[model samples]
Target: MVAKAVVKPAVELPVRADEDSWTEAELAEVRATLEAEMAALVAEIAHAESTIAEDGGGDGAGDDQADAGAKTYEREHEMALAHNARDLLVQCERAVRRMDAGTYGVCESCTRPIGKARLQAFPRATMCVACKQREERR
Candidate 1:
C-alpha cells in the first residue's frame, strides 16, 4: 500500500530575507523537510540510546579481552552516533525557531540573505556560503 503524503499548512513568512522572495510553496516545502528530518533524527537518537544502554550494561565476567573490547567499541560507536544526531536535532530546532522569529533565511554572521538554493540544499544552514567559508577559516 502506498503511504499518504502529509499535507502541511503553508508557512506565512512575514519577513523576507533581504531581496530574496520566498513563495508560500517554498516555505511550506522547507518546513515539511525540516519537520520530517527532525522526526527521523529523534527516532535515531532514541534507538542509539537503547543500543548503548544494552551494550554497556552487560557484565564482562564471562567475556575474554576481545569480546570485552568489541562491546566497548560498539557502545562508544552508539554514543557517537547519538551525539551527532543530537547536534543535528539542535540545528533543526534552531532553524525552526528562526523561521518562527522571521529570520529563517538570513545569514546570522553577515545579515545577508542565504540564497534559496543553499537553503534548499541544507535546511539547517544559518549562514550564506561566503560567511560559512570565512567561519571555517577562522
Candidate 2:
C-alpha cells in the first residue's frame, strides 16, 4: 500500500466588502493625517534649502572652518529628514492607491484583512503581523 501525503491549504484571509468595510469616518481621519504629514515635509524641505543657500558664503579662515562644520552638520541632518519625508510620502501615496483599489486594509503578503488597530497605527502597512514577521525573518 502506498502512503498518501496530506497537504494543508494556506490560510484564507478575511475580506471587508461593502457595508462591512472601513467607515467613511475612518478614511477621513487617515486622509487628514497624510495631508498634515505631507505639508510638514514640504515645509521642512523648503526651510532646509533656504538654510543651505544662506550657509554657502565666503568668510575668514577661522570663520570658514566653523561655517564648514556647521554646513556639514546641517546638510547631513537635512538629508536624513528629506529621505524620511520622501519615504513617508511614498507610503501615503501607496495608502491612497490601496484605498482606491478597495484594498486599503488588506495585507499584501497573506491576502488577509489587516486589523483596524494596525491600520490606525500604521495607515500604510502592506502585510499582516504574521506575514510581516515571516518576511522580516528572511
Model 1 lDDT tens row, 1-138: 996544333343323344346677788788889999999999999999998877777689999999989988888888999999999999998988777667787888888777778888899999889999999999
Tens digits of per-residue lDDT for model 2 on 23-113? 6677778767877877787787777677656665545356577777886787778777777877887888777666665667778877877
All candidates: TM-score: 0.84, 0.70
Q: Global lDDT for candidate 1?
A: 0.82
Report the error of model 1 at residue 19, Å: 7.0
Candidate 1 stretches greater than 4 Å from native:
1-20
Worst 10 residues of 2 by lDDT: 7-16
* Per-structure clash totals for the candidates: 0, 0
How large an RMSD does model 2 have? 11.6
Give the per-residue Cα lDDT of candidate 1 at 73.
86
